[model samples]
Target: MDDTFPKIEVLINNLYDLKQKRDGNFEASVKRVLNMLMVLEKGLWRTTRGNPSSFTDSQVEKCSLQLWNWAVAENTLSTISDIDNAKFRHVACKLLTLSDPSSINERRVRLQIEMCLNAAQAWIVCGRYEMTDDLFELARTCIEKLLDGLAGQHHSLSGSKRMMLDRDLFSIDGLQFQCVGSLGEHDKAVIAFNCVRDKLALHPKEAPFLAMVCYNLALKFHKEGKLEECTYWLRQSYDTGKAEEEYKVDSCQQAKTLRFLAHVCLQWEAPHCWINALNAIELAIKEQPNVPGFLLYMKILTLSEAPDTDLISAVQKILKHNLPSDLVFNAVRMVMQNGRESACKTCLPFVCESLSHTTCGLEVILLKMEVALHFGNEDEAKKEAEDLIAKHHSGKMLKEMQQEHMHLLLWGRASFHIEAKCYADALVWYELSASFYAPGKLDCNLAKLYRNLATCYLELHRLNKAKESLSKAHRIEPDNPTTIFLNLRVALFEGDEQNASHAMDCLVQLANQEKDSVGRLESLPAEDQETPC
Candidate 1:
C-alpha cells in the first residue's frame, strides 16, 4: 500500500457514504457531499501540480476520469446549482462520452448520444465552444452508426424513422460546422459543409436546410471579414432555396437571406448596389416584417436619392412600431446624419419614452449623448461626458465597454474638450483614443481620428507632434482631402516647401475632380483652416 492510495480510498468512501445517508436531510447531505467533492478536487489538482514530474499523462487522465465519475454518478449532477451547472456537466461528459459508439452497449447508445448532444448544446448556448468538439463528435459518431445500420439493412427502421436519423446526423454536422467556424477554423468548416452537400441534394426538403446552413456559414465569414467567401455562400443560399419549389422555403429564412444580400451588396459597392438593396429589402419586408430589418431599409433609403418627404414618411412609419431605445436611437441617428432635422425632432419624444422604461447601458447612454450633441444640446452632452468619465474611473459601469465603444467615449470627450478650448485636456483624450487603435485596420474613421489628433497638436503649437499625427493620417488615407489639406498645413509649418507643394497639388486636383469641394477648400483661411470643429 501506497500512502496516497489509502487517502484516495478514504475520500471515495466518504463521498459514497454521503449519498447513502441522503434519506434524512437530503439537501444538507447533498451540500456536504458537494463540499467534500470540492475539497477532494482541489487536493487532487494541487497534488498533480506540485509533483508534475512524478505523474505521467496517464496518471493525470486517470485521476480526472475517477473524479468526473464520482461527481456525476447516480443523479448527483442534477442536484448541482444551475450556476456553472452547465459548465460542470460539459466537463463531466468529456471523460465519459465515448468517441466509438460501437463500444457502448446497443440499448444505451441512443440515450448516450442524446446526453452528449444536450451537454454540447448547453455550452453552445453559453457561447462556450471549447472542449465541445469531443461531445459533438461522440454524438455524431453514435448517430452515424445508426445511419450506417439502416444503409446496410442491419435494422428494420421505417422509411420515416430512417429519414429522422438522417436529419439528426445532418443537424449534428451543420451545428459542428458552424461551431468550428465560430472557433475560426474556416477550412475545416468548409470541408464539413462540402462533405454533406451531395447527400443533402438527394432530398428536396433538405434544400431549405442546406440554404439555412449556408446562410449561417456566410454570417460567420462576414464576421471574420472574408467578404468574398461571404458573398459566395449567400449566393449559394439564395440559389439553393430558389431551386426548390415543391417544399417552399420558410418566409423568415428568405427574408433573412434577402436582408443579408442587401447588406453585402452595399458593402461590396456592386453596380446599382443601392437599387439592388432597395429591391431586396422590399421583397424581404413583403416576406417577413421585422423591426431591425425595416430599420435597415429605412437607413438605406435615407442614404439614397430618396426625397426628404419620402424619408420623413419612412421615419413616421418606423415610429409606429414599438421599438427598444437602441433602435429608436439608431433611427434618430440615421435621420440626423442625413440632415433630416424634422424627422429627428419627430423621433425625440419616443427616445425619451423608451429611455424612461429601460435600463441605460453604456451603448444606449453613448447614443443618447450623441443625439443631444447633434441637436446642439452642448450642455447636456458635456454633463453626460463628465458622468461617463467618472463612472469609468470609478469602475461602476454595469457592463464592460468594448474596445470600439471605449474609443468612441474617448473621442467624444476629446471633441467636447476641444470645443471648450481646453487644448491640453483635449490632447490627453485624443492620445488615449489613438492608443486604442485596432491592429490591421486603416479605415476612414481611424484616419479621421488621427487627423483630429493632429488638429489638437496644431492648436497647442506642438508642430513636431502635429507632423507625426498628420503622417499617420496621410498613410491611412492619402487621397482624403482633409488629410491632404492638413498635410499641407503641417509642411508649411515645418518650412518643408517640397512636401507642402505636393500636398497643395493633391488638394487642387481633388477640388477639380469634385466641383463642390473647390468652394469648401477656398472658404477655409489660408493660415488656419478650421478642422470640422
Candidate 2:
C-alpha cells in the first residue's frame, strides 16, 4: 500500500518484461522501458535524502540496469550524431543518482560505471572528442556523488570504496594526462601527473600504482629539463616498482625504467655514473635481455677508459647472442675502439651475415670502413666503402663513405705523387684532397691538409699560392710551430723582408712557448727552413 512501493514494483515488472522480449524487437521495447524507468528513478533519487539504500533492492537493481543500458545506447547514438547529443547528457545525469557507493548493490553500480567509462573511451578513440569530454565529466560527477554518499557508510563499504577509488583515480588521471600530452600541453600534463602522485602518496600500500605515477612524473621532468628532479623521481619509481615474489611486475616496464635511468647516468659522464649505468643495465638484462641494453652498455664501456680485455669479452658475448643489426653495429664499434683489429677481423663474418637480416648493416659497413682507415689499410677501406655504396646508395652511411673514402683515396694518391716528385700531379691530388675535406675548420686535420697543400704549391713553384695556403693553415691552427716556420720561409723566398722579419718574431715567440725543449724548435732542418720557390 506504500505510494512509492507500487511505482517501484511496476517499473521492476516492466524491466523484466523488456528483458524477456526477442532480440529482434528488444531494442525498441527496452528504449521505451528505460525512458519510463529514468523518470521514476530521477524523482526517487532527488526525494531520497540519504544513502541509495533508502530505495528498495528491486528498485536499485532496476535503476542500475537502466542506467547501464542508457549509458551504452547514448554512447552509440553520440557516435552517429554529428552534433552534441543532448539525449545522452540527460541519461548520464540520471545515472549520477543510481551509482551510489553506499547502496547494498554497490558492485552492480560499479559495473555500470565501468561500462560507461569504457563507452566514453571508445567515443574518444573514434574522434568524438567533445562528446567524450562531456561523458567523462558526467561520469566523474557521478563517481564524486557516489563517494559523497558513501562517506557516512564508511564502515560498511570501506574496502569496496578503496578499490573503486584506485580504479577511478588511475583511469581518470591517466586519460587526462594522455590527452594533454597528445595536445602538447606538457605543463597541464605534468600537473595531472602530480595529482596522481599525490593520490598515490595518500595510499602508500599501492606501491605499484605509486611507482607508475612516479615513472611518468620522471619522464615529464626529463622532458621539461629538470634533470636533478628527474633522477630523483626515476630512482623512487624504480625502487617502489621493483617486482617482489608476490607482485610479479611487468619485466618490460622494469627494463624500460632501468634503461632510462642508465641513460641519465650516462649523460652525467662521471666515471662512477657510467659504472652505475653498467650495473643497472646488467640488472635490466637479467629481467628482459635485449639488444638496446647491450648496445648502450657497449657504448659506455667504449667511451670509458675501461680495460679493453673485459670490454672485448663483453662485446664478443653480445655478438654470440644473435643480436639485432643495430646492436651488432655497436659491438663492431666497441671492437674498433679497443684497437682490437684482430677482434674486428673475427667479427666481420658474423656482422656481414647479420647485415642481411637488419637495416643497420649499412651502418656496420661504414663503421668498418672507418676502422680500416684508422689502421691505414686503404685497400680494405676502399673495398668496404665500395660495397656499402653499392648496397645502400643514400643515407648517413653512404654519405660518410663517399666523403671519407674520397679524402682517403685522394690523400693517399697525393702522398704518392709527392714522394715520386711528380709535383704537378701531386698538386692536383692535394687540391682534390683539400676539396674532398673542405672547407677546413678544426685545428689538427685542417692544419695537416693545408700544410700538404702548401707543400704541393711550393713544389710547383707557385710561391704566392703556397704562402696563401700556409697563412690559412696558420690561422686555423695558430700554435703549430711548423706552419709558422713555413710562413717565415715563404716570406724569405718571396723577398718580402718586412713580413719575413715578422715571421721570425713569431718563430722566436713559438720557441719560447715550447716549455720542454727549445732545442727541438732550433733543430728544424735547413731544407725545411728554405722555401722551394
Candidate 3:
C-alpha cells in the first residue's frame, strides 16, 4: 500500500547480494544499502497510519539483526577508533522504536533489550552519555514487560522458571547499576545497590551479582579517595561474597575481593587492621590457591610479626609453584630476621633463580647483602653495600622498587652498626634512614628507629640526646613496653628518680605476670617493618 515498500524491498535484495560478495567494495556497497534502508525506514514511519506490528514482519527481524550486528561491530571498534556518531544515533533510534514491546513478539522484545544494552555501552565508550537515555529506557521498558508477563503467571511457573525470571530481572538491574555508577551518579548508584541488596535473598545465584555491584562502587569511591566509604562497600562485598562457595558461584571473585580488602586494610587504620588483613589474605589463598595470593599472605605475615614457623610454612607452599623473585626475597628476609639460618639459606637459591629471570637485580643483590650481614660476614656485607650504593648513584636500578630497596638498605646498614657497637657510624645511618620519612611521621619502623637512636646515644653517654630521642619514641608509641623501658633508662641515666619510678611502675603493670618480663626491643633491626609500599 505504501510507495516506499518496494524501495525497501529493493534495498534489502541488494543488501543480500552485497552479503554474498566478498570483494574490496563489499563494505562500501553494504553501507550504501544500509543507508537506503534507513531512508526507507524513515519514510515508512512518516507514511504509515496502520498498527505498528504491520511493519514488524520477517523482513523487519532480519533487518534488525543486521543493524544490531553492525552497531556491535562499530561499537567494539569505537574503543580504538572514532565512529560516525550521527549514523550510529540514527540506527540506535530506529532500533529502539522498532523494539517497542507493544509491537514486537516476545523473542524480539528480549533481543531488543540485549541490543539496547549493547548500544548503551557503546555510547558510553563513545562519550555520548546523553544518547544512552533512550537505549536504557527502552531496555527497562522491555524488562518490565517481561517481568509483568512472569508475574501474571507466577502461580503456575515452576521453581526453576521463577529462579530464571529473578535472575534475568536482577541481571538487568545490576547492569543499569553499573552504568549509573560509571556515570558518577553516586546517589543513584547507592540506590541501585540497595535495590539489588533487598532482593538478594530471593535467589541464591544472585550473590555474585551483588558482590560485583559492591566491588564496583567501592572501586569508584577508592579512585575518588573517599576511604571510609570505600572501606564500607568493600566490607559489604567480601562479607556478601563469602557465601558464594555455598551457593555454587565462582569463588574467584570473592577471593579477589578479599585480597583487595586486605590491601585496603593494610593502608588505612581500620579496626584490627593487621588481624583483618591476615585473615582476609589467608582466606583468599584458600579460596583461589594461587601464587600471588600466597605472596600476599607471606607479606602480611611478615609485617604482622607472625611466628617464624608460619613464615616457613608459607615458603614451603610457595616452593611447590614457580617462585617469583619478590616472593623469594621477602621469604628470605623474614626467615633471616627470625634467626632461621637454615630456612634463609634454603630460600636463597630460589631467589637467585628467580632473580636471573627478572630485571629486579638490585633487590636481589640487596637481599644477599642482608644475608651476608646476618651470617657475620662483615667484609662481604660492606663491599656489597658499597656496590649497591655505586650502582644506585649510576642510576642502574629499576625505578619501581628502588626507593623501597634503598630504605631497607639504609635500615640494614644502620642495624649492622648497632650490632657491632659502632655507635657513631650507627648514628649516621639511623639519622639518614629517619630522613627518608616525613618529619614527625610515626610507624613501626619509625618507632623502632627512634628507640635504636636513643640506644646509640645512651651507649655514647650522650645523656641529653638519649632523653630527647626517648621523648620522641614515647610520643610515637606510648604503650610500648620497650619505649617505657627506654624512658626508664633515660631517667636513671639523668638521675631523675621520680620519672624513673613512674616508668618502672608502668612497665610492671604492662607485664603484669613477671616484673622482669619487660619486652625487649625488636632484635632483628631490619625486621618487622611495615611500609605502605
The best candidate by lDDT is 3
Which segments of candidate 2 are over 4 A away from where they belong? 1-68, 73-214, 236-247, 334-370, 377-533
Total clashes, candidate 1?
A: 0
Q: When superposed on Cα atoms, how far off is each prediction in RMSD?
A: 19.2, 15.1, 17.3
Scored against the true structure, residue 336 in model 1 reaches a CA lDDT of: 79
The TM-score, computed over Cα atoms with residue i paired to residue i, of candidate 2 is 0.45
Question: lDDT order of candidates, best first?
Answer: 3, 1, 2
lDDT of 1 by residue, 1-533 (tens): 12443354455466567667756675566566455545544455444443323334444344435544555564355554442444445444442331232332443456556557766766665667775787777777777666675557666677776676676676676667657766767678678777666566656677776787688778888988887788677877877777456865777888889889888767876557778788888787777777768787876787675666666666555556655545555666787788766666566555555464455544445665666666766567656555555554565443434345656656776767776878787776666556544456676767778778788787778888888888888788778787787777788888999999998888789988997775776665433322322
lDDT of each residue in 408-520, candidate 3, tens digit only: 76677676666676888877767765655555677766777778788788888888888888788778888877777777777888899999999888877887865455644
For each candidate in the order shown, give its overall lDDT on alpha carbons.
0.65, 0.63, 0.68
Candidate 1 C-alpha RMSD relative to the actual structure: 19.2
Candidate 1 Cα outliers beyond 4 Å, as residue runs? 1-105, 126-130, 140-155, 194-223, 229-257, 269-272, 289-533
Tell me how candidate 2 scores on lDDT: 0.63
Model 2: per-residue lDDT, tens digit, 1-533? Answer: 12553564575466456555646766566566556655765676566636434455555555445544644554565532322233333444444444344453455546555655665555545445344565567567556656666665673557867776667756766556545544445467568756665665444455676567567767877887766667776776777666454563478888888888888888887887888888878777776778877877777777675565666566666767766655666677676866777777767776667564565666666667767766767677667756665565343334554455545655765666566777776666556445434233464665677777777677677888988888888787887777876777687778889989987887678677775434665676532321111
What lDDT score goes with residue 191 in model 1?
A: 86
